[model samples]
Target chain A: MKIVFIFLISILSVAAQLTLMPHLSFLAATPNLILASVLAWAIWRPEDKKEWFILIPILLFDLVAGQPFGLITLSLCLVFFCLEELGLIIFKQNDLPAVFSLTFLGIVLFELFQVLLSRLFAVWHLMEPIRLTAFYFYGSLPFNLLLNGALSLLFLWALNKSKIFQNNGPLAKLK
Target chain B: MKDIDKSKWIKFFIVLAVILLLIFFNFRGLLSAPKSWALFAASPFLKLFQVMDKGVSGSWAFFLAIKDLNKENAGLKSENQFLFEEVTRLKEVARENELLRQQIGIGQAEQQRLVMAEVIGYNPTLGQYILIDKGAKDGITVDLAVVAANNFLVGRVAEVNANFSKVLLISDSDSLVNAITQDTRISGVVKGNHGLGVLMEMIPIDAQVAVGETVLTSGLNETIAKNLIVGRVEEVIKKESDIFQSATIKAAVEFDKLEQVFILFP
Candidate 1:
């Protein structure tokens, strides 16, 4: 069932890339659905011992997209673990602040991670124009937050409707 | 409970094995291995996706056709007038050369090798990269310059395979080119600012840099030919106590509208 969910998320991410987000760029920023989905899964199933599932899509993203290897994987893992710990505190409720804060942190960390890796690799000079980086971060922050927040809520909603949120075991009780 | 624990370990082992295989392939650089089989397997689905995207773009284009047609018509009329004037100017130059007994130096340089390529697809996940139809077999190599119509430098080849090559646009974060002002001879490095625009850095603070000046490649590296059209200076920035000024460049080539490019062979 987790495998099926991962496949569905992958298809949705590809579809979003092809259709919904074509030419929708905020200064070079686009919606990161794969990142969002992986975060969602990490938060949804914190105790599943299936961290590799999160790593799979990230590896595929790096491979198919031609980014430096392990870049997205590293970022996603960091975001996943951070959010998974945060998820422990907020697990009882699906409130707006919890969702928005987590999504916002995800975006910030993802961008920071990319910049840090690029700097460490000597891909681009650091201390270049801060305006460009500032514009991209401030410009895309709200939209990314909203998009990821909606996705997180939707995932939580689905799990709740399916009774997975109420179950404390590996398998959710069927309705 | 013991059986459940055993099953969990088995599942974990399977997942771990898959991850290990992926990591091995990634480190080996085999993740980008020839995609002949995968392309064959996924062709049908890709075709469907293409059709859907085309349908969406087509509908939008249809709605805006009238406005676009009028703009195109106006552009063509001015271009025709400019061409007529250019023809007369060329004729005058030829006549003067004949009268002065001076040899016309036309066609003395090495033959220009151009390979025409179509951009069949782009990776949306990778915002600053594009794939062209021509590849290593066609003499495309890493760092080869790519230009659009009217000889505007668009990007350089970043990755090459048998039949396809990827061009990294100037808008990418990693792109940096040595460029100079066409009018003032002021030199600087044009670096991609990732999102807002490209910035020309390290220009001496005393240089008379102005907005709207044309920037061209300096050919300092011998990788990009001299005087290639890079961009137009949009803004000049000066900070107090700084020894150098930076300028923002508006790239001449619009990367978003790119459909075809000419890859220049070394």
Candidate 2:
């Protein structure tokens, strides 16, 4: 049931990302909905081994994406793996600072992976070569960080405040 | 603990293998059917969210513009009267031109066939593209030129599925179009500036150009038609040492506000 819930949320977020998020962009930066949701969920339930179910949605995003196939999935998986391992080793609790820090790092890592893969794919003639410039990194990084950070913070606050992840809620067993 | 660690590694390898397979299949053109199916399944939700977004944005815009409604209404009323007269004059000229063409042994000017499509999605993260609700089934093939109202150049059809297609916006970094200035007749390559804006590049260093001159497609490219408005020159950048000059262009089309577009058929 939890797996199904994750799949549905992922689908909805992907749909919103492609359709609705563009209208909400600020400073040429749009919040990455799937990335924020996955990071927040990982922090909320670290022991949830069914997280791999997200790959299904990631595959769908890749299919609809303009970039080379599988790049988004691979990049996101690597980020999730690192976050899970690092959280276990460093942060014993899901505190506010830890959540913000992880959110910031996850966004940066995911974008860096995208840039690197885009360059590699260009070399392989998968698409046109992306020009790497300082503006490419600095132009939208501040706004991107702020948007995704705010989203993660909101998710964390709601998880801690609501009874959805506690007591007799549907996902209490997973929690 | 050992079992958990084993499963994690197994999952990682499985993901890696899947990625490899996807890349291979995508490059070999084997993923088109699956991709088409995916787009087909996701199209309804995309269209729904797009309509919702338009409604929300429209209401917000109306709320914000309430203060200036009187001024805009007065301006639009005068502009509409001028356009009404201009249309009447153009109709008279068109009738005379048709008779002249017939006398010159030309039967008639061929009319351009355009297929109108609604934009359902915008991808700003991975690339600058908009998904339209028309595709191979509607004769929207790859590389077809897309235009907004007033014959303003938008972009080209990048990829096509059965029920939808991806239109790469002219502001995308990968987009390039052959364009020429209206007055000066100086030709250049108009390229996207990483989605920041559009730039007309590769102009001859000695060519005479100025700001506010309209840029149009040169028809040098087969896919795009000539005389289609690309944009107006916003700035001119000339250097003594450089072989080619470049200028920034201000496109007439508001890419963010595009709800519908027409695909030009050859």
Candidate 3:
């Protein structure tokens, strides 16, 4: 059942990323809703899932987004692992400010990884790393972080209402 | 027993290892088969979305025209009459030009193979690419140059699936074209300017060039042909003591207005 929910979210996000973003894109950057949702899940949910759930979406994004196969998957997995550690050591779960901060950091890391990795692995990415990095940080940070927050809130709400996160559910014992 | 069970971190690591292997295979061209299936699955939704988007935009345009119908109709009537007279004069001039060309023994260039396509998707994060509806099934392979209205170079087909392909616009950071100034013949390499515009770099500092001079492909390379208008020089950036100079460019095609493009298979 949870797998079904994850699959739905992944497909919808990929579809939206491909079909809807061009109409709404400004300055060539848009908030990545799937990245935010998965980061939120990694930070807020217990560490048992290991973001194995998001691997499908990352792989799908690779194929559809025209990025090098496995680049985003690797980056998302690394982000998931880092978020797990950050949650364990500092932020912990259920903290609003922490969640927000995590979302911001997650986006930073996500874009940074993408840009740097594209420069390294992908064909023909010669845009100055500093300029691309600065655009995301200065030009897009506020709008994207807000959107990421809203998406995280929706994910949190959905996870909260799910029976799997409820008492006597599979995750409850892990919690 | 539970303590001896495999940990999630271990599981995650295992997946990461597999992904890394796939990345290695990607460099070997081994990962394309699975990716083709993914593209095949996504193509239907992209087609549906393109249809719906066109419908919505078309209706919006209709209402927008309705708002200005009276004002535009009055102007269009006079413009139509002027265009009809101008076209008649231009046709006579064209006939004379063709005669002169024949006398000089210049003939039309060979017909180029073209495949028309519709813009179906754009992903800015993937370093500036748009998905077009025509693909391998439509004879669009990689490295074919795409042109918009007036033969303006829009991009080149980067990746192709069965029913869809991705065009990497010249405005993308990774894109490079060998270009020269049309008026002065100052040559340089044009690169995408952070997805906002393009930059012509690697020109010698002493070269004479001016803003608004046309830049066209030098045809020094096999990927893109010669004499295709790239952009008009927007800004000339010259620095003393620097070996090379650069210019900002404004591409001719209005990308936001792009809907149809032709792929030059030749």
Candidates 2 and 3 compared: the better one by TM-score is 2
Give interface RMSD, every candidate, in order. Answer: 4.4, 1.6, 2.3
lDDT, candidate 2, residue A133?
A: 65
- Backbone Cα, N, C clashes tallied per candidate: 0, 0, 0
Write model 2 residue lDDT over A1-175, tens digit each, in one string: 7766665666677788898887777766788777776666666653334567667677778787646677787788778877776677676576777777788888888888877877888788877655666766787788888898788768766766775655565676762
Q: Which residue pairs show backbone clashes in model 3?
A: none
lDDT score, candidate 1, position A33: 61
Give the residue spans of candidate 1 off by over 4 A.
Answer: A1-12, A15-22, A45-56, A89-96, A116-133, A140-143, A146-175, B1-28, B34-51, B58-76, B87-107, B120-127, B133-139, B161-164, B206-213, B236-242
Descending-DockQ candidate ranking: 2, 3, 1
Put down candidate 3 lDDT per residue, A1-175, tens digits, no spaces.
6665555557667777776665665565565666766786786664344356777777877766645566677777778777777876688655778877777788677767766666666353422233455665665666666666677777766776774655556755552
What is the docking quality class of candidate 3? medium
Model 1: share of real contacts kept? 0.11
Best candidate, lDDT = 2
TM-score, cand. 1 vs. native = 0.73
Global Cα lDDT for candidate 2: 0.81
Give model 2's docking category.
medium
Q: How many residue-pair clashes does candidate 1 contain? A: 0
